[model samples]
Target: MSADTSAEWFDPDTTTFGDRLAGARELAGMTQEELAKRLGVKEKTMDDWENDVRDPRAMRLSMLAGLLNVSLLWLLTGEGDGPGDPGVATSYVRGGIQLMEEIREISVQMKLNAERLVRVEQELNELLRADDAGAA
Candidate 1:
Protein backbone atom coordinates (compact mmCIF):
# COMPACT_ATOMS: atom_id res chain seq x y z
CA MET A 1 0.00 0.00 0.00
CA SER A 2 1.08 3.55 -0.69
CA ALA A 3 0.61 6.63 1.42
CA ASP A 4 -1.68 9.32 0.04
CA THR A 5 0.05 12.27 -1.55
CA SER A 6 -3.01 13.93 -3.00
CA ALA A 7 -3.50 16.16 0.02
CA GLU A 8 -0.73 18.62 0.52
CA TRP A 9 -0.43 19.92 4.09
CA PHE A 10 -0.03 23.56 3.13
CA ASP A 11 0.37 25.70 0.05
CA PRO A 12 4.02 26.48 -0.51
CA ASP A 13 3.32 30.01 -1.63
CA THR A 14 1.37 30.83 1.51
CA THR A 15 3.52 29.04 4.06
CA THR A 16 6.07 30.95 6.11
CA PHE A 17 9.59 29.76 6.90
CA GLY A 18 8.67 29.02 10.50
CA ASP A 19 5.67 26.96 9.43
CA ARG A 20 7.82 24.87 7.13
CA LEU A 21 10.45 24.44 9.81
CA ALA A 22 7.88 23.23 12.34
CA GLY A 23 6.05 20.88 9.95
CA ALA A 24 9.28 19.33 8.76
CA ARG A 25 10.45 18.80 12.31
CA GLU A 26 7.16 17.10 13.26
CA LEU A 27 7.21 14.90 10.16
CA ALA A 28 10.75 13.91 11.01
CA GLY A 29 9.41 12.69 14.41
CA MET A 30 11.70 14.89 16.46
CA THR A 31 10.84 16.88 19.57
CA GLN A 32 12.09 20.45 19.83
CA GLU A 33 14.36 19.53 22.73
CA GLU A 34 15.92 16.67 20.78
CA LEU A 35 16.51 18.86 17.76
CA ALA A 36 17.99 21.61 19.89
CA LYS A 37 20.29 19.16 21.65
CA ARG A 38 21.50 17.82 18.33
CA LEU A 39 22.13 21.37 17.12
CA GLY A 40 23.96 22.30 20.35
CA VAL A 41 21.46 24.99 21.27
CA LYS A 42 18.88 25.58 23.99
CA GLU A 43 15.33 24.30 23.62
CA LYS A 44 14.07 27.88 23.99
CA THR A 45 16.17 28.83 20.94
CA MET A 46 14.42 26.17 18.88
CA ASP A 47 11.04 27.31 20.23
CA ASP A 48 11.82 30.88 19.23
CA TRP A 49 12.65 29.86 15.70
CA GLU A 50 9.56 27.70 15.37
CA ASN A 51 7.35 30.47 16.76
CA ASP A 52 8.86 33.00 14.32
CA VAL A 53 10.27 35.10 17.12
CA ARG A 54 13.78 34.48 15.73
CA ASP A 55 15.45 32.89 12.72
CA PRO A 56 18.18 30.36 12.62
CA ARG A 57 21.57 31.38 11.24
CA ALA A 58 22.65 30.06 7.84
CA MET A 59 24.77 27.25 9.25
CA ARG A 60 22.06 26.20 11.70
CA LEU A 61 19.43 26.47 8.98
CA SER A 62 21.46 24.18 6.73
CA MET A 63 21.87 21.71 9.56
CA LEU A 64 18.13 21.82 10.31
CA ALA A 65 17.30 21.06 6.69
CA GLY A 66 19.66 18.11 6.72
CA LEU A 67 18.43 16.76 10.03
CA LEU A 68 14.79 17.06 8.98
CA ASN A 69 15.51 15.36 5.64
CA VAL A 70 14.31 18.32 3.59
CA SER A 71 15.92 20.61 1.06
CA LEU A 72 17.49 23.84 2.27
CA LEU A 73 15.53 25.85 -0.25
CA TRP A 74 12.28 24.29 0.90
CA LEU A 75 13.05 25.18 4.50
CA LEU A 76 13.81 28.79 3.60
CA THR A 77 11.49 29.72 0.74
CA GLY A 78 9.18 26.68 0.70
CA GLU A 79 10.44 25.91 -2.79
CA GLY A 80 12.37 22.95 -4.16
CA ASP A 81 12.06 19.46 -2.67
CA GLY A 82 10.21 18.72 0.53
CA PRO A 83 10.05 15.69 2.77
CA GLY A 84 10.24 12.20 1.25
CA ASP A 85 7.60 9.50 1.28
CA PRO A 86 6.15 9.02 4.75
CA GLY A 87 5.53 5.31 4.04
CA VAL A 88 2.77 3.04 5.43
CA ALA A 89 4.12 3.47 8.97
CA THR A 90 3.50 7.17 8.84
CA SER A 91 0.00 6.98 10.34
CA TYR A 92 1.28 5.27 13.47
CA VAL A 93 4.15 7.70 13.76
CA ARG A 94 1.86 10.65 13.34
CA GLY A 95 -0.44 9.36 16.04
CA GLY A 96 2.52 9.01 18.37
CA ILE A 97 3.59 12.51 17.59
CA GLN A 98 0.17 13.88 18.42
CA LEU A 99 0.12 12.04 21.72
CA MET A 100 3.56 13.32 22.60
CA GLU A 101 2.56 16.87 21.85
CA GLU A 102 -0.54 16.58 24.00
CA ILE A 103 1.53 15.18 26.84
CA ARG A 104 3.99 18.03 26.62
CA GLU A 105 1.20 20.58 26.73
CA ILE A 106 -0.40 18.92 29.71
CA SER A 107 2.92 18.80 31.50
CA VAL A 108 3.37 22.52 31.07
CA GLN A 109 -0.13 23.21 32.32
CA MET A 110 0.46 21.02 35.35
CA LYS A 111 3.56 22.97 36.23
CA LEU A 112 1.66 26.21 36.04
CA ASN A 113 -1.09 24.84 38.24
CA ALA A 114 1.46 23.70 40.80
CA GLU A 115 2.96 27.15 40.96
CA ARG A 116 -0.43 28.72 41.45
CA LEU A 117 -1.23 26.27 44.23
CA VAL A 118 1.98 27.19 46.02
CA ARG A 119 1.13 30.87 45.91
CA VAL A 120 -2.34 30.25 47.24
CA GLU A 121 -0.94 28.17 50.06
CA GLN A 122 1.46 30.95 50.99
CA GLU A 123 -1.35 33.50 51.02
CA LEU A 124 -3.52 31.30 53.27
CA ASN A 125 -0.64 30.82 55.69
CA GLU A 126 -0.12 34.56 55.92
CA LEU A 127 -3.80 35.18 56.56
CA LEU A 128 -3.90 32.53 59.33
CA ARG A 129 -0.84 34.07 60.99
CA ALA A 130 -2.45 37.51 60.92
CA ASP A 131 -5.63 36.14 62.42
CA ASP A 132 -3.69 34.44 65.22
CA ALA A 133 -1.88 37.67 66.05
CA GLY A 134 -5.16 39.56 66.18
CA ALA A 135 -6.71 36.95 68.51
CA ALA A 136 -3.61 37.03 70.81
Candidate 2:
Protein backbone atom coordinates (compact mmCIF):
# COMPACT_ATOMS: atom_id res chain seq x y z
CA MET A 1 0.00 0.00 0.00
CA SER A 2 1.68 3.13 -1.17
CA ALA A 3 0.76 6.52 0.25
CA ASP A 4 -2.53 7.67 -1.20
CA THR A 5 -3.36 11.35 -0.92
CA SER A 6 -6.99 10.67 -1.74
CA ALA A 7 -9.46 11.54 1.00
CA GLU A 8 -11.21 8.26 0.12
CA TRP A 9 -8.42 6.55 2.01
CA PHE A 10 -9.34 8.16 5.33
CA ASP A 11 -12.48 10.13 4.64
CA PRO A 12 -15.20 9.57 7.19
CA ASP A 13 -17.83 10.22 4.54
CA THR A 14 -16.95 6.94 2.87
CA THR A 15 -17.20 4.88 6.04
CA THR A 16 -20.13 3.60 8.10
CA PHE A 17 -20.59 3.96 11.86
CA GLY A 18 -19.45 0.40 12.43
CA ASP A 19 -16.35 1.02 10.33
CA ARG A 20 -15.51 4.03 12.47
CA LEU A 21 -16.01 2.04 15.63
CA ALA A 22 -13.78 -0.81 14.48
CA GLY A 23 -11.10 1.54 13.23
CA ALA A 24 -11.13 3.52 16.44
CA ARG A 25 -10.93 0.36 18.50
CA GLU A 26 -8.01 -0.89 16.47
CA LEU A 27 -6.25 2.45 16.76
CA ALA A 28 -6.68 2.29 20.52
CA GLY A 29 -4.94 -1.12 20.45
CA MET A 30 -7.87 -2.85 22.10
CA THR A 31 -9.35 -6.17 21.10
CA GLN A 32 -13.07 -6.99 20.98
CA GLU A 33 -12.80 -9.14 24.14
CA GLU A 34 -10.82 -6.50 26.01
CA LEU A 35 -13.15 -3.69 25.10
CA ALA A 36 -16.17 -5.83 25.87
CA LYS A 37 -14.78 -6.66 29.30
CA ARG A 38 -14.18 -2.98 29.99
CA LEU A 39 -17.68 -2.11 28.83
CA GLY A 40 -19.21 -4.98 30.84
CA VAL A 41 -20.79 -6.32 27.67
CA LYS A 42 -20.46 -9.73 26.11
CA GLU A 43 -17.90 -10.26 23.36
CA LYS A 44 -20.75 -11.32 21.08
CA THR A 45 -22.44 -7.99 21.72
CA MET A 46 -19.28 -6.15 20.83
CA ASP A 47 -18.98 -8.23 17.67
CA ASP A 48 -22.57 -7.48 16.76
CA TRP A 49 -22.03 -3.77 17.19
CA GLU A 50 -18.82 -3.82 15.21
CA ASN A 51 -20.45 -5.91 12.50
CA ASP A 52 -23.38 -3.46 12.31
CA VAL A 53 -25.93 -6.00 13.45
CA ARG A 54 -26.79 -3.82 16.45
CA ASP A 55 -25.96 -0.47 18.01
CA PRO A 56 -25.12 0.57 21.52
CA ARG A 57 -27.39 2.75 23.61
CA ALA A 58 -26.63 6.46 24.06
CA MET A 59 -24.71 6.15 27.31
CA ARG A 60 -22.77 3.11 26.21
CA LEU A 61 -21.98 4.75 22.90
CA SER A 62 -20.60 7.75 24.69
CA MET A 63 -18.47 5.60 26.95
CA LEU A 64 -17.24 3.60 24.02
CA ALA A 65 -16.24 6.74 22.15
CA GLY A 66 -14.40 8.04 25.20
CA LEU A 67 -12.64 4.73 25.84
CA LEU A 68 -11.56 4.57 22.24
CA ASN A 69 -10.34 8.19 22.37
CA VAL A 70 -12.76 9.37 19.75
CA SER A 71 -15.65 11.82 19.76
CA LEU A 72 -19.17 10.45 20.07
CA LEU A 73 -20.24 12.31 16.97
CA TRP A 74 -17.32 10.90 15.05
CA LEU A 75 -18.10 7.41 16.21
CA LEU A 76 -21.74 7.80 15.30
CA THR A 77 -21.52 9.93 12.19
CA GLY A 78 -17.85 10.29 11.33
CA GLU A 79 -18.18 14.06 11.38
CA GLY A 80 -16.11 15.16 14.37
CA ASP A 81 -12.65 14.27 15.62
CA GLY A 82 -11.75 10.67 14.99
CA PRO A 83 -9.31 8.33 16.64
CA GLY A 84 -5.68 9.36 17.02
CA ASP A 85 -3.05 8.21 14.60
CA PRO A 86 -2.32 4.54 14.99
CA GLY A 87 1.12 4.97 13.40
CA VAL A 88 0.35 2.70 10.47
CA ALA A 89 3.48 1.52 8.73
CA THR A 90 4.21 2.50 5.13
CA SER A 91 4.67 -1.13 4.16
CA TYR A 92 1.22 -2.05 5.40
CA VAL A 93 -0.28 0.88 3.55
CA ARG A 94 1.53 -0.14 0.39
CA GLY A 95 0.30 -3.68 0.73
CA GLY A 96 -3.26 -2.49 1.09
CA ILE A 97 -2.94 -0.36 -2.01
CA GLN A 98 -1.57 -3.31 -3.95
CA LEU A 99 -4.44 -5.49 -2.84
CA MET A 100 -7.00 -2.85 -3.81
CA GLU A 101 -5.43 -2.52 -7.24
CA GLU A 102 -5.50 -6.27 -7.72
CA ILE A 103 -9.16 -6.40 -6.77
CA ARG A 104 -9.96 -3.64 -9.24
CA GLU A 105 -8.12 -5.48 -11.98
CA ILE A 106 -10.02 -8.62 -11.22
CA SER A 107 -13.32 -6.75 -11.31
CA VAL A 108 -12.49 -5.33 -14.72
CA GLN A 109 -11.59 -8.77 -16.00
CA MET A 110 -14.83 -10.22 -14.67
CA LYS A 111 -16.85 -7.51 -16.37
CA LEU A 112 -15.09 -8.19 -19.65
CA ASN A 113 -15.75 -11.89 -19.32
CA ALA A 114 -19.41 -11.25 -18.64
CA GLU A 115 -19.65 -9.09 -21.70
CA ARG A 116 -17.98 -11.80 -23.79
CA LEU A 117 -20.45 -14.36 -22.48
CA VAL A 118 -23.36 -12.16 -23.41
CA ARG A 119 -21.99 -11.69 -26.92
CA VAL A 120 -21.51 -15.42 -27.31
CA GLU A 121 -25.06 -16.05 -26.20
CA GLN A 122 -26.35 -13.52 -28.74
CA GLU A 123 -24.34 -15.19 -31.52
CA LEU A 124 -25.64 -18.58 -30.56
CA ASN A 125 -29.21 -17.29 -30.68
CA GLU A 126 -28.59 -15.78 -34.12
CA LEU A 127 -27.17 -19.08 -35.34
CA LEU A 128 -30.18 -20.97 -34.05
CA ARG A 129 -32.48 -18.55 -35.83
CA ALA A 130 -30.61 -19.07 -39.12
CA ASP A 131 -30.72 -22.86 -38.69
CA ASP A 132 -34.47 -22.82 -38.10
CA ALA A 133 -35.00 -20.64 -41.18
CA GLY A 134 -33.01 -23.11 -43.33
CA ALA A 135 -35.03 -26.05 -41.96
CA ALA A 136 -38.27 -24.26 -42.75
Candidate 3:
Protein backbone atom coordinates (compact mmCIF):
# COMPACT_ATOMS: atom_id res chain seq x y z
CA MET A 1 0.00 0.00 0.00
CA SER A 2 1.02 3.59 -0.64
CA ALA A 3 0.63 6.71 1.47
CA ASP A 4 -2.09 9.26 0.86
CA THR A 5 -0.37 12.31 -0.64
CA SER A 6 -3.16 14.81 -1.07
CA ALA A 7 -1.88 16.85 1.83
CA GLU A 8 1.42 17.35 0.04
CA TRP A 9 -0.10 18.57 -3.21
CA PHE A 10 -1.04 22.12 -4.04
CA ASP A 11 -4.13 23.05 -2.11
CA PRO A 12 -6.67 25.03 -4.09
CA ASP A 13 -8.55 26.23 -1.03
CA THR A 14 -5.52 28.16 0.20
CA THR A 15 -4.45 29.58 -3.15
CA THR A 16 -6.00 32.10 -5.51
CA PHE A 17 -6.20 32.03 -9.27
CA GLY A 18 -3.46 34.60 -9.52
CA ASP A 19 -1.14 32.45 -7.46
CA ARG A 20 -1.65 29.48 -9.75
CA LEU A 21 -1.19 31.57 -12.87
CA ALA A 22 2.02 33.12 -11.63
CA GLY A 23 3.42 29.77 -10.52
CA ALA A 24 2.65 28.16 -13.87
CA ARG A 25 4.25 31.07 -15.71
CA GLU A 26 7.37 30.83 -13.60
CA LEU A 27 7.60 27.09 -14.06
CA ALA A 28 7.20 27.54 -17.80
CA GLY A 29 10.15 29.95 -17.73
CA MET A 30 8.27 32.82 -19.36
CA THR A 31 8.17 36.35 -18.07
CA GLN A 32 4.84 38.11 -17.70
CA GLU A 33 5.70 40.46 -20.55
CA GLU A 34 6.61 37.60 -22.83
CA LEU A 35 3.42 35.72 -22.03
CA ALA A 36 1.36 38.85 -22.54
CA LYS A 37 2.98 39.51 -25.90
CA ARG A 38 2.27 35.99 -27.00
CA LEU A 39 -1.34 36.38 -25.92
CA GLY A 40 -1.62 39.77 -27.64
CA VAL A 41 -2.30 41.55 -24.39
CA LYS A 42 -0.55 44.45 -22.72
CA GLU A 43 2.03 43.62 -20.09
CA LYS A 44 0.01 45.62 -17.58
CA THR A 45 -2.99 43.44 -18.36
CA MET A 46 -0.95 40.36 -17.60
CA ASP A 47 0.23 41.94 -14.39
CA ASP A 48 -3.33 42.78 -13.46
CA TRP A 49 -4.38 39.20 -14.04
CA GLU A 50 -1.49 37.79 -12.04
CA ASN A 51 -2.07 40.34 -9.28
CA ASP A 52 -5.74 39.35 -9.05
CA VAL A 53 -6.93 42.76 -10.15
CA ARG A 54 -8.54 41.23 -13.24
CA ASP A 55 -9.21 37.93 -14.97
CA PRO A 56 -9.06 36.93 -18.59
CA ARG A 57 -11.94 35.80 -20.72
CA ALA A 58 -12.31 32.20 -21.79
CA MET A 59 -10.23 32.54 -24.94
CA ARG A 60 -7.32 34.16 -23.20
CA LEU A 61 -7.59 31.78 -20.29
CA SER A 62 -7.39 28.83 -22.63
CA MET A 63 -4.40 30.33 -24.34
CA LEU A 64 -2.68 30.94 -21.08
CA ALA A 65 -3.15 27.34 -19.96
CA GLY A 66 -1.82 26.13 -23.26
CA LEU A 67 1.20 28.39 -23.16
CA LEU A 68 1.98 27.42 -19.62
CA ASN A 69 1.54 23.69 -20.33
CA VAL A 70 -1.02 23.20 -17.59
CA SER A 71 -4.54 21.88 -17.78
CA LEU A 72 -7.24 24.50 -17.73
CA LEU A 73 -8.87 22.84 -14.77
CA TRP A 74 -5.59 22.86 -12.93
CA LEU A 75 -5.02 26.50 -13.81
CA LEU A 76 -8.44 27.38 -12.50
CA THR A 77 -8.78 24.86 -9.64
CA GLY A 78 -5.33 23.35 -9.04
CA GLU A 79 -6.67 19.80 -9.40
CA GLY A 80 -5.15 18.47 -12.58
CA ASP A 81 -1.82 18.12 -14.32
CA GLY A 82 -0.14 21.26 -13.21
CA PRO A 83 3.58 21.26 -12.52
CA GLY A 84 5.23 17.93 -12.06
CA ASP A 85 6.47 16.96 -8.64
CA PRO A 86 10.18 16.73 -9.14
CA GLY A 87 12.44 14.43 -7.14
CA VAL A 88 12.34 16.83 -4.20
CA ALA A 89 10.46 15.71 -1.14
CA THR A 90 6.79 16.65 -0.94
CA SER A 91 7.29 18.38 2.38
CA TYR A 92 9.93 20.62 0.87
CA VAL A 93 7.64 21.53 -2.01
CA ARG A 94 4.87 22.41 0.38
CA GLY A 95 7.19 24.64 2.36
CA GLY A 96 8.42 26.34 -0.78
CA ILE A 97 4.89 26.94 -1.94
CA GLN A 98 3.98 28.45 1.39
CA LEU A 99 6.97 30.78 1.22
CA MET A 100 6.09 31.81 -2.31
CA GLU A 101 2.56 32.61 -1.22
CA GLU A 102 3.82 34.74 1.63
CA ILE A 103 6.20 36.58 -0.64
CA ARG A 104 3.43 37.22 -3.11
CA GLU A 105 1.26 38.68 -0.41
CA ILE A 106 4.06 41.00 0.73
CA SER A 107 4.75 42.10 -2.81
CA VAL A 108 1.09 42.95 -3.32
CA GLN A 109 1.03 44.97 -0.13
CA MET A 110 4.12 46.87 -1.23
CA LYS A 111 2.54 47.65 -4.58
CA LEU A 112 -0.55 49.02 -2.88
CA ASN A 113 1.54 51.09 -0.49
CA ALA A 114 3.60 52.50 -3.35
CA GLU A 115 0.45 53.55 -5.15
CA ARG A 116 -0.83 55.18 -2.00
CA LEU A 117 2.44 57.05 -1.58
CA VAL A 118 2.24 58.36 -5.13
CA ARG A 119 -1.25 59.72 -4.47
CA VAL A 120 -0.14 61.27 -1.22
CA GLU A 121 2.78 62.93 -2.96
CA GLN A 122 0.49 64.31 -5.62
CA GLU A 123 -1.83 65.74 -2.97
CA LEU A 124 1.10 67.32 -1.15
CA ASN A 125 2.36 68.89 -4.35
CA GLU A 126 -1.06 70.32 -5.05
CA LEU A 127 -1.24 71.75 -1.56
CA LEU A 128 2.18 73.32 -1.96
CA ARG A 129 1.18 74.91 -5.24
CA ALA A 130 -2.04 76.23 -3.71
CA ASP A 131 -0.08 77.77 -0.83
CA ASP A 132 2.35 79.42 -3.22
CA ALA A 133 -0.52 80.82 -5.24
CA GLY A 134 -2.20 82.15 -2.11
CA ALA A 135 1.02 83.86 -1.05
CA ALA A 136 1.33 85.47 -4.48
- Go through the candidates in order and give the C-alpha RMSD of each one to the true structure: 10.4, 16.4, 12.7
| Model 1 bad stretches (over 4 Å) | 1-8, 85-136
Query: Which lDDT tens digits does candidate 2 get at residues 71-122?
Result: 6788888887776564441111223433454456557668999999999999
**In model 2, which runs have C-alpha deviations exceeding 4 angstroms?**
1-9, 88-136
Model 2's C-alpha root-mean-square deviation from the true structure amounts to: 16.4
Q: Number of clashing residue pairs in every model? A: 0, 4, 0
Q: Determine which window of 10 residues in candidate 2 has minimal summed lDDT.
A: 89-98
Q: Report lDDT (CA) for all predictions.
A: 0.72, 0.70, 0.71
The whole-model C-alpha lDDT of candidate 1 against the native structure comes to 0.72
Residue-level lDDT of model 1, residues 1-60, one tens digit each, is: 113532465478777887777777777777899888867689999999988999997667
Better of 1 and 2 by lDDT: 1
- The candidates, ranked best first by TM-score, are 1, 2, 3
lDDT of 3 by residue, 25-94 (tens): 7656678999888776899999999889999977677667667767789988888978555222211123
TM-score of 3: 0.55
TM-score of each: 0.57, 0.56, 0.55
Q: List residue ranges in candidate 3 displaced over 4 A.
A: 1-10, 86-136
Location of the lowest summed lDDT over 10 successive residues in candidate 3:
86-95
Clashes of 2: 4
What's the distance in Å from true for residue 103, model 1?
Answer: 34
lDDT of 3 at 69: 63
